[model samples]
Target: MKKILLGTICLMAMAACKNEPEKSTQAVVAGESTKAPGPVEFADQKYIDMGKASLAKFASGDIDGWVSGMANDVVLRWSSGDSIKGKEAIAKYWKDRRMNMVDSIETSKEIWLPLNVHQPQSVESKGIWVLNWHQVHATYKNKQSLTFWVHLDMHYNSEGLIDEFIQYVDRSVINAAVAKKK
Candidate 1:
């Protein structure tokens, strides 16, 4: 009788242990263990398609088409310490450059490669960001050529338009190309 009671108690304890939920080893924000972090998500095909379309518009020298993807109050932050605010400002900036300096934009050798995209699941306030590695080849009106690599980050607004555009590049290459004319 005692042996039967002891075995029953041992079986109950084992069953209780098995019913307990397992804990995850993954890290979470604010030490909250209720939710485990998910794997990093890459840009979907839609984002890639949008990026390719925007690049195509740029390559074709369609300033209006390129600007169409941006929000009305878009902010452009360049690595060269230039900040352009508003869609109108961006349009004027590009128009000035196209009219004054650039002779043609070559897209045959240009490449815009999507590197990574991160959308934090825990952070609700943070928006999605995409990293694009670019290789731009352009020819100046003076027949001088410039080719450089640029890193671009784009933040999309809730309306699916690009709200913030940031570029990282070595401007010295462009400056040298311009200085050659002088």
Candidate 2:
């Protein structure tokens, strides 16, 4: 099942990028010139970089490094309808429950997509928002393993710190895995 899901995600990603225009070193604006100006950069590259780095740290079980990218007042909302506010509380929650329960986590696949919306308010926002699709393989301390998909919608503040993180995952899979161990 995990292999099937991973394969499907890979196909989807390939199909999504198939139709994209070939990137050139220069972006033509107002039909200026054929010569490229310079390498184009994504507007949200920094936020994406920070997010990827945080995920890498999490995958490597570096809880401290992962939490370091968050804002002091970061708000984290879990799919189980629990909300943790402030960096300290979030760290404690993870350390007590999550980090302790899960022996290790490995990301099988990740895709970062822009928030597709057309609104003036969204356009004028001070921060950038990204939706990340993550397929993770988690192993519990009891040696139980589960592969799950998580959707994370993260908002980065102007200082490039994650201010809001909304995680969507099916908790039943994890619950069942734990129940089977008992």
The number of the candidate with the highest TM-score is 1
RMSD of 2: 17.8
* lDDT accuracy of residue 47 in candidate 1: 66
What Cα-based lDDT does every candidate model obtain?
A: 0.74, 0.77
Q: Give the Å shift of residue 147 in candidate 1.
A: 1.4
lDDT of 2 by residue, 1-182 (tens): 99999999999999988876777777678947775433321344656677788889878877788889899999998879989999999888777766568888889689986542223253233446777899999888777999989999887776778888889998888877866663
Error of 2 at 106 (Å): 0.6
- Candidate 1 wrong stretches, greater than 4 Å: 1-40, 107-125
For residues 1-182, write the lDDT of model 1, one tens digit per residue.
Answer: 99999999999989888855787777768836564434444445576678778878876778889999999999988888889999999988888888787877755433444323334556322455656776788888777998777777787777878888888888788767866763
Q: How many backbone clashes does candidate 2 have?
A: 0
Which candidate comes out best when scored by lDDT?
2
Q: After superposition, how far is residue 49 of candidate 2 from its true place, in Å?
A: 1.7
Estimate the lDDT of model 2: 0.77
